[model samples]
Target chain A: MQATESVIYNRAGQRVVSPEYLLFEAPRTKHFMTGSEAVKEAVRRASVDASVSYPITPQSEAAHLIGELWVEGYVGVYFRGESEFGVMSEIAGCAMAGARTITTTSGPGTLRAFENFPMWAGTRIPVQLVLMARGVNSPLSIQPDNLEVGFLLDTGCMIWYAENAQDLFDMILAGFVVAEQPDVHVPVITVVDGFFVSHTREAIMLPPDDIALPPYNPYRAPMPVIDAEVPPGRFLRDPFVMKSNYISYATHASWQWEVRSAIERSRPYAKRYLKGLIEEFGDPSAELVFVACGTAAAQAKEAVRLLEDEGIKARVVKLKTIRPFPVEELKGAVKNAKYIFVPEFNVVGWLEREVRRYLYGHSDAEVIGSPRVAGGMTMPAEVIVQEVLKLTGKEVKHVL
Target chain B: MMRKRVNIRMPALGGQGAVTAAHIIATAADYEGYYAVSNPFFGAEKRMAPAESYARIGLEPIFDRGEVVYPDVIMVFHPQVITMGKSYTMPFYSGIKRKGLIIINTEEDLLTDEDKERLESLDVKVLNFPATKLAIDIAGTELSTNMAMIGALFGAIGCVGLDAIEEGIKSRFLKKFVASGGTASLDSALERKFKKKLELIEKNLNTAKGAYDLAQRWAGEQGLEPFLPPPPKKVTV
Candidate 1:
């Protein structure tokens, strides 16, 4: 992909925004902050209009930190909704009202907010969602279960994962840019592991002061005006819209079709931002490439380093974007590689399923190692090392 | 002196502020130009439940977010964790690496004959301090024991500097002073525990100094190695 100049704009579609929407580069500061804290500050840097809060562990620190920022006058609007369902509904309403809204949730909460996922997409309202990955009450467990992620794969929203706090900050920043695009408006679910990324502390560079993306400017060209600019006696939607026997079915089906095509059309924009988000590490020509995102990729980097010492040449395909899945780039990166190893934190290997779909027929699916250790369990580099050694018919030795 | 990368595991009670100490240690490591990953293994248990927090400081980004199965240093914030067998996996020095460091919060020898024998077999270095007593005597409360332990850790590993830890403390506590103007929230109980916010943080720092001085003096007498950079690997090829 050819690199484009970092051109900033004030108006997207017919909507006019503040002049500051254009490029405003400022100095960034490096801070030792947890992934959750970094994300909270990212939300502040973005100048989000309003964000709902329904605190759960791992993700609670993020909500709490954002609340602190809000109290200190750094954030615009922060509130704890009645529940996850209420929080999603409130964000939906806020987004429709041209509010740059966001919210964070985990396993069970994601399920509770299920009814509103389609609502946000069907209406084409772009709201940033911070999903701290967790198991969804799988056998009454409260650890990192990631079926919440797989369950959302078919949902109309775009998805991205952060490998570390650095990626966490950049991904969310770009997530807003990609989601709020006039032609491809859709909510983006940004994921981080429950405890791994959410709770762990690391070095993060924050955006400089006076630098932020423009606020959400809804394009009201085709939709009804959300502002108070409608004519005093202008006729709105027909009272009995569904009773229009003929066009009702066509209108409903077309709306759903548009939601999907918008995501397809979003491929270019997603690819543009994702190019900056994705990092490919390890030997490109090796027999196996460990494909992972979020914390799993963090460990994969270390595991690849160790494997190199043992003469087992391998590489890592660190995936950042999953929804507008990086099919083309990922295919190219692993073309010479023989096997794909996907270490998932979720019980259901959603990431592996994605790998198989894009690399179908070309790559055998079974070599995609799905040695899952779920339920708040973290797969250490040693675990991956032992498994890889076992798969290569070598005597497995514990490196840790 | 520096080390390639080191894992320090601190096991304490849920309400003992070990997790915060772990974060400060990581922050200190960051200030010292190293990568650090600090995380707490918390379950559904409430206050007084055994909590294990870990910090891995290294040259590169530390990624394995798993239990420190082979910790180079283990600091026990509470003595009962060993006596009561409260640890989840690393029960005391069970997984200490060879020539590792073990710092306990008790002055009196609390380890069993079996524990001492195991330590001798592993050739691990041990540093003991009455951290709770030091906190009570200096800070007028036992809550600063974690700070005391932090001081002793500095004395032993010397991987990070004292000024870094001080800066880490300031960044963490100063925010609380500002946040106090807002609504009463998660830490209101602790806020109520301290009559004044200044007293709470000041005493904690003073307690950290007390432990640091004690460990520095005590470690010298034991002939322990000062904090130094790791020697390069000797290749046999």
Candidate 2:
């Protein structure tokens, strides 16, 4: 199919012909911080108006740190509530009131927060949530796991998985834009590895606030404003009006298709942003590129470094934007690589499976899965490196 | 720039205020204008399965936020934790820096000759202070071990003075103790403990002429720097 040109008219009322250009300058780099700190910084950079959060392990620090930012008057409204339900409800109310709202939580909290997900999606509220993957049900441990993301897969919200601290920082920043985009008003949940990325600290190049984020777009609720002088009209009671609104239902479904298309359309832009990051630092191209998100990605980078020192070509493509999954860019980046290691802090059942599916028809690269059970324990870098070597038919020297 | 970073891990079961002791040390350091961060490594372990809390103090920013795999100081609030030997002590001992200090809250005679030999071989400066005894003598209850440890930390670091320690204790523990219905008694106990430690230091000065003179003299004789102990060797089976 031939790509048709979308015409553009200049201010002089004359047609102007120009090919599409997707380009962005490199963002500045700063010192490292945790995923939670990154999320809080993103919220601050995005000028998020309101945030509500409840305490949950692994994810609690994000909420606490954001609350600290709120107390310091760096962010907007902050509410510390009794439960995750209350936090989600507050986010929904804030979003409906035309505020850029956010809330963070973990596995069970994400599950409880999921009740608000459908409503928020239905109302087309642009709320951002940082969901830390943790275990639920099995043996009951409070360590890093991805069971929560599995439960959230069916939800209409876009999911972004961060492989390490740096990706966590970038993904949170990107999520603000993706969630607030008018064409894609679905809430975005950026999941990071609990305990591993949530609590662990590593060197992260945080983009400067002024350098990275675009202009803020405040949420607009569907409810129309009423005036005293104007005669009151029935809002939801008329069948004809409901039928006309059913057109909105079609619009909503089409909006979902548009989101998918925009995601594909945004590929070149995403690539430009990533290239900008690389230009500021350097390209992280290794022989075997480990694709991961959150803290696991951080470990993968360290592992790659260790492997490279041991005469192995290993690099890590840490996914900073999970939702609006940068599938095309990832495929393009790793298509030439021999092996793509995807390590998730959560269970292997969902995201890894999805990644494998995404890569199935696109690349011939062998996507190896290293699924760490939820709440098990932090998977050391040495273990990840050894796994990569094993997958590449290299002798493993270390075992954890 | 490299700065001295010390992680103090307390060995006490739940409800023993071991975590509070670590917090007090961290808060005391902060009060002294040193950067400090404290976090508890709490798990499913209940009252007796050996709970540990970590406190990190540094002049520079701290990066590694995991469990204190290598600690400059390991402060044990319970003597039984040491008696348990390899099982309870190995995890703590494994992380001790080469020139680390290990302060055990017990009577001096609690360590066996073999235990002393083992620690000496590892080059660990083991100080067996009767913190519980000191607590009972001053506070009339062994539960004031956290306060006693704070006093000991003040004695060891010397950077944090009694005033800062008192303020830290007041800010962190006073309200909590009062809320738990032991307000007056806990305050009096804390004051008495502080007074006793002050009296000991005053007496030490009168006898020895300079503060920490005896400690310095002993450490100098052993070719060790004052307040800076020798690093412990990595334990091998």
Candidate 3:
């Protein structure tokens, strides 16, 4: 079966199972927690031993929380850095040493780190970082924004956005799985709403502790081994021989293909994991499907349920795994639907422009991109439903 | 039969305690052992511009977390919001269930004849309580209208009782307000001052039978029955 069909069948099978039979369900824990606190829980759950960070608005709390964890002995190492460059360097080093590492930043910090993220991807490091998003020098003052994530789309880093507090938790949990996948040994950056997810408080359901950890496969690199006796003898090298051997053009080409193939190989694993997670939560078959990530997905889900209650057949397909771009699976899930609404926290400058380009050639569905202009002020669920209803040509009631 | 879903909308604005009002209503319904969910409607609005928060209360767990379209009860905290009727109120009225109620936190005399007639024509039960005045009288400020409005709603619906609302408010707001000092005082004051409106609603319900008898007799003598208004205009967006 096609990967998408496999996902649908798996979801159907999961629906056949009762909630009582699911293992490792997230507990319905009610607490007033900011998005950063929830992300902190994911880092804790992932057993991150070290975090390197520089303080920035919105994302600063995430680093602070990690610091608290380190002080409390939750992790083995923590580093407060002076700049984004330093943080990423430390993260790469720690991850190379087999420690799960993370870094947190927003806006300018995110831009600074982007310079090195591709290098980490090229080197097959599994460093995880949180990119709390903010507006990119827009006319409006600082607030929640997603411009940076869009800019880094082709950087080979696995990227996803959190729609709300719950999504933040789920993405953090899922990020580890994506980052450490054997075939996709690439870095991951989980983007969350700067003001919405980073500052706001909402109830969340936390997965239980006893859930078995997903299998981990460490990245394999060929390290040069030297023995004292064998290494002592060396032939005097000619300049041409040294250059050809040191800069093997073939090695670079092979490694580049491996990086590309690794990302492609991660698709099936992502689909399986997302399908399992959704089945454990709610059913996803409906007439209209709303696609969003990060905190926007939370609002979209609520909007879908509201529309459904009003006798409109609607549901939400939250893209928890955005990095591998779960395109095939998403296309399959939304293929039969009449309309798809993609609400984005950022302007569709280049990133969404690319997604639209890709989606256009693949699917015939009419995809509407609703770009939110204001800073991360919460988009009322009502507004989202109304937009979806309009797209689907459904009758909507007005509140006067 | 599907039970009627009542939506209680708090006008959207910052520092207006709109979210607090929505929470109190939801908690009150839950206290009454009814399945309820309260969601705050947020948008980018200036400090004085209208914004809305909403509560969805029913016997079933609320599946919709969006804005209440056809609210059985629509509550407006700011009087100016009524003028923004073209934008906010239009959407609200389009979804109002039959025999729904519209509650405005202003004195009855403040409504123009046109405003009252238009709402009454829709078969909407309109109640204009001087909640701001009541709040000022109780707390020496005009900030407690949301609470007073909630009190009036409890009296109006009776699905959730005043005691349950009080407990909901005390447990949800007062304790927090006290600890937060000035931060929570406005919310506490609103809840406390709205008790009078609840009392008025109870009194009205108690005397409803006599009023119903008198109305019936007058209708019989006049040889007329009330006419139903045309259905509300459908909104596409």
Candidate 4:
């Protein structure tokens, strides 16, 4: 069966269109566009309340597209911030006003926004941020890599990866849904590989304008709405007051615990909203399973196909929804496999590290991962097929 | 029981419009109602660097992404791509499938006699089409040679209809022309090419058709059979 693009379909296998933009024509079922263009279209359909952003390569096109839509009055709030730090700050304020704000950044921009990453969870604000993955900072090459994503892993936010432009369109909608839930009010990071996905053009079947995603509905009335007289959460007790009473210390400590637990509770919501954390193909009982996320996942799928013709069977378990880690889903998919081969484009190999952390249950299935495709090197199916041949104790000289 | 998916890899130098040529082919196939995925793989340098773009055309939704390593067809945009090589420094023939077709856009074949004999022994079909020469002859400027290459690809592959490619070329170029209001768009067209709006379109179309005819004639002379869809099998139920 063909891998389908429609996320929501009916019994007849036809896409179930939502009754929104019955008049708009932008989301024509299948339009050949770049991933950046698709994200722009998705954001227009999302009807965001605000998008305060600092321009950066790979991601700037998306931000610009959304800005154009906003300027033409198809979208809601839009702003140009001086820096990534200011952009994140705007997101926090707009989100507090119950605005469905969104933004995107890459490479050095991610570093600029580092301080505000944890603050999104601290304030329980659910902002949808797209990290078009890039190597964070110095040497200043504008190529695709996931090093920036590695830094944000511990920043108290839910993360997801998109394999292509179509997935980029779908993930944004799903991300907002999970982030806005009453029980899970943490922000979501929907990542796409810079240049690889952003610049590449392909056909993406977006929901028709009328059937576009519904606007984000915040969990409750936002704090400190002067119009409604709703009060913001009090910060009356200082840390010095904690010296006066242990109970006060516990109350302040609960804030940190609440954010962590909130993200943990978002796991089921992620599975529900974003479908399974993985999209698996090939044989589960094969000697090896190619585990990957983002652009590498797409490359792995192609490699698996090449290997199949050579009488070497393999499975592909693509990590889609990246956090709350998706350990169980990956564990289940790679259960019968003896090895997991992960290829990433960052020197850190964070994707492989994350896999090893979760693949502990399957003691027999060893995780073999490396920064196989790093820098500006686009990972080819030949490289992956070569890796699989090495594992089977076959001659690596020329077979693959 | 799935139809074969075709992977085509094209390598070109910077500023050669190689990436655009790849897009045209993929877009033409897509316009013909097939699923086509195209992407360009380039390094940090903007110009004068060797680059490669790829395309995967199939009847099904193609989940595959990145460069087409195991290419069914290899189209070299310039003979220099073989001579100059890539920025990351990899050989051109590193991932080409055996017994596949190689179409290079040059007047004379770049392959040495030994390499030609070696490739022939492997059943690989290698052809040299004077794409840029035809473009300069038909379109006055060599800039639209990419269009000529697309025409040659359609005539050579025959997987996608030549009519679809012609239509694809028109729609892609006409996007800006139509968007800015037809002949009133002549300012930029004239500024860039010293040609009127309609004249620019006419030249590109003629150049593409000219290349297509030459490539089709070569294919016919070589006794190469055009790709045809398989007949539907009877269902047992």
Candidate 5:
């Protein structure tokens, strides 16, 4: 494949296909690598227009790899930003100028760039932020602690938690497809636990590099493109100016609702592209269940297996999307469950609260948050087993 | 009876290539058609600091991640991990399973009498050898110490063949591999020492082969059974 002035073709000379064909129909070969490498491979086929990066642990290597892609001609524009705040604004500018934009950040960086997220949603720019979650500062830790994700829950960006390296690869590609939809033109935040997913090596199947998802079409956006090819929206030309009138107040209120509604509108697309908003595994008829996401869900899967070995029935309801929370699908999955355990890597039990709030009157199952490992502690499968046995009044076996 | 899953914990000082060893072991297991996962300890890793990594190999899909709290095998890549108590766990052999194996890279036995008695109670066997010495003797550099450790791991397990190990080593060195910042630097240092890429791989392979022969002979004499069942039919890729 040759590179034209504007369009870039992969080395195999294959034309870009639809997202569905690229994700499902295309044959994939297995590769053993880390999630950072997975990010590079995914962006290699994403047809990304521009990327701005800042330095942070567990995410800097991936950001550097993307810069390498830029040098390799897979990405159109790339540069290092002054800071996370500046980087977020720079990517927002890229998106506003009708360029497909992506960036990454970790714990403190996420908070430092916090203001741009809501603005990204309000302006309806479909930029994707791959948030490698880590511990917030004040004690200063660079390990994988997802307490930062709790702060982004209300940021209006569509949130999706990836379980492992394979999930990270697929979700990133699928995230762009879902976020760029006309009805769902909101920013997407693909969250993965730092270090655990970013540094761990595992096997993942990837589609051929020759094939890629079709390029971003700014014309399909619900809002007008801000580039020279098209005139910008009249009201959007200058959005910061405010008039203290009832119309302004009402417009502000309704637009916030609409931004959230756009996230809700992404359900069908996310469900279809991600295969499901929630993945189920283990005994289908089990009464004991685990509701988790990210590495917690991976640990829960292993716990399910260990629980099964002891003749106890259990299952895992792994949540793929946090925003536009799959309430109905979750309700359907936990209908038969009597004891629901939520395993998490943070002290806040944010997922447990979400499960409880959503299931307040829908189900009678007792929601219990167990084995919360904070400050980047490892929540091994054995810890989950002990939690399960202790909660269920079963004798804890020395299985290890 | 053959075990279905084997979790190996490696504790060593930073820059000792424990993380690389973990990656190669899992990659070799994957080549032999087993599900495997490997990861380093989540911390600020520095040179000479207590660094650890874990690998899980099983017939079924392995989902557990992070540090291996419980291990069927423990490979101590440095004498300091035992003598200086430069380890995350207090006893260094804290969670070894019954009849598990511990391979220590030291010329002398570092276990105290009480420690040996505790290990004996758990029926765990300790294999001590100067792995760094073997690396210097065969590879002419101590940087290949990880290669020797990997060899001993597969030697005692008696499952992954030498050809698969070779494939794992080739994929790691010949391809654009990224384990961490320190490991990448160490890799370049090895390349500079060998002067050629193929020669570097050849030296590392020779170091591993030397350690493999010694460990295999010792394992056979000790009647150590296969740590894992024969991996599902090898998929030639």
Candidate 6:
């Protein structure tokens, strides 16, 4: 059977709808799917111009599905690259050449492709990297652990964390729009906890396949597109390593600062397109709060329900945007909290550090990095509840 | 009172189709208008290796993700998952809730006396049936074993109707579905054996029907109530 009977027409013939129209206004039908499948559905409607692929566990199926999209003519140009480094570079070239480019990688693959991220941002190429965060190798692991995201925190790419398949679908479609804005044009790395999302099947609402997001307009880029239209900018044309002058050092430093600024500028567009940079769940005035992202947020939301059952007031401030940290939205979300818990899949508790760093002067709540799971371990909500109980000096009522 | 939410865990050997079963059960539940979620164990699966998967169906949206540490039901698709200690969780019934159900696919009882005592204290019921035998007998292939397991699950639960199960099966096989690389290849192998795709689907459906009937009878004999409330009735204006 054809992979998608719904993909009836070439992308060229598809009617291009606005991102808002595609996301909010279009009629939707609920379908059961895994996170990887959700990626294919998103790419099908994304009006993507190019995609590069490399095989990595948890992300391989999603990458394969995108290649299927290419074969079916939804994606204009698609090919498999030699490695994650090669794949990342290929996508950067596609974006620099004025193609709306996308790609997928995980764990070691993400780390392998690390150099291109900052370069893509420095080049101001609006490529979308769907990073399926998995465990990095020391002793190798293929299971879901998001430690790699910590490594990419300073990569100058606008980072988004999707809690599950549905969030992934919406973020990818909106990711392109927000990342491609003239003022905010930079690489967008949408991270979902590998396997937890990449392999898990759940229900998500999808817009009809006949419509698609408006195609990328390379002419609108703040930087010149390297399509031989206008002569490529001098800085883009030459490698900065050739010049050993003080101006080159200043140029590199200022350009890195501008890349960071571009990420900050994405906040308004991201807040508007993604609906909010953070999502609040559970009691609005909850004193016990959790600041989390990706699957940790999922576990925390479940913990909220279990806490409710125990007559505990708890809430979750799920951070959707990680690089352009939702500082203001988070402050508002946790204003009433006396104790804030940050649950994370990585051992570093990078999210906890971010929450602590941002809320230093804003809130007096004691920030605790509790119930951290690493090395591909699964964090059940019960673990979170037990942690809360122990921290509160209450009797532990649940364990798993 | 019926459960508003039910979490089911299936620990089976790889290639046994527990992952596919989990997907179809969740799909069937979704078709019945209930919120459902499913996932496989995060591991590199190989044939005969312990491969676990989970499915949660509920009246409310299921926010819980990753492994189902505490399951309302446990379905053991192969006796090796019990006899050979081939399971991710110990005793093949770890973290099962009180008054839950376990359906095993062997005709012979595989649980140790200690296992029986623990389950009894928890008020859990164990249903031992030859699901693979049913698959071989009805579908003329052992590959339909997961189909029998799916039937037995819904049959004992008595929540999702057969129509929804058929729809789930149809969507899985007839329509373009993505689960895993191994699953897709196994599907092609089954189709080649059956000669036609429609015939393959029909035989698989019959296998599920046969097992469902057997499970229904067993549940009736044990005076088991439906574990979950029936899917909320369709609202028609």
| TM-score of candidate 1 chain A against the true chain A | 0.88
Every model's DockQ: 0.41, 0.06, 0.06, 0.37, 0.59, 0.56
Q: In candidate 2 chain A, what residue range of length 10 has the lowest lDDT sum?
A: A16-25
Write down the TM-score of every candidate: 0.88, 0.63, 0.62, 0.84, 0.95, 0.95
* Candidate 2 docking classification: incorrect
Kindly report which residue stretches of model 4 are placed more than 4 angstroms away from their true locations once superposed. A1-28, A218-229, A232-252, A394-400, B1-3, B44-49, B82-91, B109-118, B174-199, B227-237
Candidate 3 local lDDT, residue A246:
58
Clashes of each: 7, 19, 23, 2, 0, 0
**Residue-by-residue lDDT tens digits, candidate 3, A1-400:** 1223322212112121112212135344444345787877766555565788798776887788877667655556887877888888778777766666778888877777667887777767777788888866656445666778888777778776666666677766666666677667678778876766675444456654323232232423221112222332552211122555556666667767777777777666555544432211124566566677765666676676567667776777766666667666566776676666777766653434644665776766777776354454446567787777676677887442
Off by over 4 Å in 5: A1-14, A232-238, A244-246, B176-195, B234-236
lDDT of 6 at B135: 96
Candidate 1: Cα lDDT at A153: 79
The deviation in Å at residue A251 for candidate 4 is 4.6
Model 5: per-residue Cα lDDT at residue A127: 95
> Model 2 over residues B1-237: C-alpha lDDT tens digits?
122556676667666677676666666566655555555553544666677766767654443333565566777777667666522346446656556677777775566677567667767787666766766666556667666766665565445655556555554533311212443456688789668766644432232122123334444555654332222231111
Per-residue lDDT tens digits for candidate 1, residues A71-96, read 76656678999999999999887776
lDDT string for model 3 (B1-237, tens) is: 233456666664566667777777776666665545665553454566666777766654343443565577787776666655523655434556556666666664445677567667777776666666666655544556666667766655546665556655654533321222354346567676457546643432333222223334443554432321221232211
Q: Residue A168's C-alpha lDDT in candidate 5?
A: 92
Runs of candidate 2 with Cα error greater than 4 angstroms are A1-46, A61-82, A161-174, A197-255, A259-286, A308-311, A386-393, A396-400, B1-50, B53-237
After the best TM-score superposition of candidate 3, give how far the Cα of residue B129 lies from its true spot, in angstroms.
6.2
Instruction: Residues B51-141, candidate 6: write the lDDT tens digits.
Output: 9999999988888878888899999999999889999898789899988999999989888899999999999999998999999999999
Give fnat, all candidates.
Answer: 0.61, 0.02, 0.04, 0.56, 0.74, 0.81
Which of the two candidates, 3 or 4, achieves a greater DockQ against the reference? 4
After superposing candidate 1, which stretches have Cα over 4 Å from the reference? A1-25, A72-75, A220-222, A228-244, A248-253, A364-366, A397-399, B1-3, B176-195, B221-223, B226-237
Per-residue lDDT of A1-400 in model 4, one digit per residue for the tens? Answer: 1244746633222333432231223344667878888888777666577888788887887888877767656567887898999999888888877777799998889998889988887677789999888765567777787888888887878888999998898888777777877778888999989878887778877655534455555536222322243444553312234456556757658877877788888888777666677888886678788888888888888777777877778888888876788778877787687777888888888888888887776657878884276665678777877777777676665543
lDDT of each: 0.75, 0.60, 0.61, 0.74, 0.89, 0.89
